[model samples]
Target: MSENVRAKAQETLALVDEVNAMVLSDPKAADAVTPLSQADANLGEEIRSRMDEIDMTDTQSIISFGSGAQTELQEISQAMLADVRNKDVGPAGDSLRSIVSTIRGFSVSELDVRRDRSWWEKLLGRAAPFAKFTAQYEKVQLQIDRVTEDLQKHEYTLLKDIKSLDLLYEKTLDFYDELALYIAAGTEKIKGLDEADIPAKEAEIAAAAEQDQVMKAQELRDLRAARDDLERRVHDLKLTRQVTMQSLPSIRLVQENDKSLVTKINSTLVNTVPLWETQLAQAVTIQRSAEAASAVREANDLTNELLTSNAKNLRDSNKVIRQEMERGVFDIEAVKQANADLIGTINESLQIADEGKAKRAKAEEELQKMEKDLRDTLASAKSRRDGVGDTSGTSVPKA
Candidate 1:
């Protein structure tokens, strides 16, 4: 019985260590920003049901222990009476003396050999059968003390296991919450840039141009440039939205798997630990009987099976998380490609705008030069005609 309890304690501690490592290393909790899915909700409900079962099992086990303890006490009492009636008082007294001495070495103050010896002396002179019965009672009491100690230790270990699991669960939830908030805030920021900032800048530029305020050419250029930049930003924001939408499914899948994993851990903590306690308690109750060893073996086997099942579940969940993470990475790459395309488009448009502005300026300069040349030619022609006399002409003829 002691060996079984010790083994269970070690196993519980190992489980605690394993859980701590897993929680600390879990990347999904760190990265998953998506909301929980329907599958996640269903898994949570299933885990809750399993927890309810554990509670019911614990309750029933307590009732069973109470009834079983009572029955065992009566049976032990009957056996003591029979042994007293049939066996030699001297041999029973000697056996009890040895048990008391051993218990005393372990500081079992309740079963004081010295006090028992005095009581035995008195009963020996008066009644040998009663003395035999007293010895048997002392032996049973010692066994009860040992079993009680074992149960207390087991309970303590189980409580530790539950506490560790609860800590892990809280940490996992906190990480996910942080990730969700991060994603939400990013989405809101992009929306504001697209819907609010860009439109406001465009309006400001249009108003400035309409008033025709004698602003510096540089200032006008800056305003127009700011408007163009905002337009590009709006395009970028659209791409971001597209990428986020595309990634949502993968994110949701990862979140679902992560939630399932946490639920599994919770189920192990709530269900497995209590179940082990109950089974060990049952085994302890029968530890003085011929069936003690077999009871312990059965309990161990059941615990091993539960652990194996939990491990398999965790492995499957981990695989889903990895796959979803890979999908998320792919979605991110798609977003990068979209941004690259947007950049190329914006650059090409800017280049075309610059070329158009240059062409219009050159055309205006050429038109002004042609008008000046025509005016010069007309002025020269008039001067030459004025300078030439009305040659010969009319005046001489009139004379």
Candidate 2:
């Protein structure tokens, strides 16, 4: 394969390896979950591990596809390079044309001078053999050209396949990243649920009960109950207001003004006991109304606090989700890039294959040259030095 193709393939493989490493994300690796509780942290770790596993699986698949495409491309590039080199195409044509031109030019220039030479010499002087060889090479060159052209076309198709593989790699990487972020976010949410805010609310409820104002309101309940009972009892008595007013001191003074009638009037007062019952009922009604108003006010104040606290909790949780999204920490894009990079790395093997060819060829060439030189040296050395085996020959008796 050409060097460029080999280099690209190598780059792809390296990238794939890098992507795989990222995807592998060491099973033992751990990272912190910020602002998370212990439970959330544990959950996050587990999720991260799972994400890594998924990433590995996904990256492996992407690598496989990419590698396959790369392999094909490398093969194509190699075939093209091989065809270009091995096929006696353009270079052969150039060499043959040069020979034919040289022969024709020489024949034209030496035509008169060749008349004196023998027929055989003149025949040989025209370079007929060179012309024949050039014709033969030109014929073979056509086949080489056809092969090289086909190989070039195949290389073009390989480039398209590589591009497709690259695109696939990028998409997979994006998906991987998205999945990771989503899982991370979900884990966090689960952690939130596990670390439920209800406990705090329960604590608040407990604390609310202990507040002095709340306790005071609770104390007033018994007083209100007592007042209600008293009102009920007073209503059953059915005392008249007019008779109740007669029990007052001002009314009693008028009755006492008749001193001669005072003993009978005083005796009449015993029948006026229902009038005092009426006055007691009025007093109870006024006091109960005041107490009820105070209780209602206290209840409303406490209820408002409960509503406010509950609203705050909902708002806070919503804010957490929003903040997390805004932070971009759980972004899917990173995963996608990683996946794509991994896919590209997979294709690198193809590049490696392409690269290995040139090195192999060069090494083979060097080996052949060394062998030829060694043969020549051996032939020279044998003439000078006797074919002496090593000075010391080990001969061990059978044990």
Candidate 3:
């Protein structure tokens, strides 16, 4: 080697030694960045940790680099909405039916509840009717308690989801750091190859050619090929680093979606839920205002009122049953939604198909464009070696 090349080789070795010393001497730096070889080993281990190591209950989550994170988040949003829906105490639409059911629970008919002197006195004077009503009110109060407890549980669950997002955010930060270390190491490795290894090989190849040392030149070419293979690995590492870059934003998007869901749940817990509870209380107050009339209505016309109510209920029930039975299994609105979803899925599929078709066409065009160049190169090679043999004692067999 020339003095300059020798000096350059020494400098490269010194630089590599300096890097090793830096990593080994500094504990913080050592922890932060693993060497390229060790990083590859770590990556192999990471890939090896598959389903058995993963949480079985993590089915609700999207894996780190997989698809459908947005879709999974959307489903989570829908589930959050569903969790808090129709959470009031009782069925608010059926007041008359509620009152009738309360009255029937006592099993005292119109005649029994009426006031002559003996039966009414034994049944607690005029308060006999209020007994079942008050009992029903107590039952409703218990129902409200149950509903409130359920709401609190859901709130707790949502808060847990928020904490889960925090955990995910922390994990993402770790991933970012890991990816940075990997990219830095890989870039350093590639830089070393480009600056030192390939240049040294090229210099040796040139000196060999000058001396007409064909075997040495051939051996140098093999060394260059080895470097090229390392370059390919570095290229793959860079692509992996790119994927890690993509993972950062994708993880953040997932975190942001989780935050949004938690925000909505918090809003329901902090604002909407209180308002709903107030509305429920006001509704109970209004229902209480109707209880006095409900308590006293059975003197003699109680039987007539009951009969009319029963007949009306029967008629309403029959009409509802007939209308529902005559109706198709699928509602028009449901059918419309299904049609919309189907169209959207088909359109998405077609879009993907078009993209694939375009890619295939482009690939074919490039292949055709290269075909002539490839043929020309082969023809040139054949002409150069037509009657000539390898002067290095390497034989080329007849094709």
C-alpha local distance difference test of each model: 0.46, 0.42, 0.50
- The reply for model 2, stretches above 4 Å from the true place, is 1-128, 197-399
Winner on lDDT (2 vs 3): 3
Query: What digit string (tens of lDDT, one per residue) describes model 2 on residues 1-399?
Result: 234433443444443343224321111111222322343666566555433332212334222221222344445446555644654334323433443343333322221221355688577774543343344344543443343333333333333333333433344333333333333443443343335533443444566645564654543453344334333322322122122222233322322232212222222222222233243344444444655776788899999999999899989999998888787655688878988899888788778887899899999999999999888866665554443553322332122
Give candidate 3's error at residue 52 in angstroms.
33
Q: Which segments of candidate 1 are over 4 A away from where they belong?
A: 1-177, 180-399
**lDDT of candidate 3 over 1-399, digit per residue (tens):** 124433433343433333224211111222244444455876544433321222212322212322212344445446545654734433322432443343344322322323344575567755554454455445654544444344334444544454444444444444444444544444454456578866776676677656666766776565555445444544554455455456556645654554444444344434543554465455445555555455655444788888999999999999999999999999999999999999999999999999999999999999988997788767766665655564522443344
Candidate 1 accuracy as TM-score: 0.21
Give TM per candidate. Answer: 0.21, 0.21, 0.34
Using TM-score as the measure, the top candidate is: 3
Per-residue lDDT tens digits of candidate 1, residues 2-26?
A: 4554455455555545533553223
Whole-structure CA lDDT of model 3 = 0.50
TM-score-wise, the better of 1 and 3 is 3
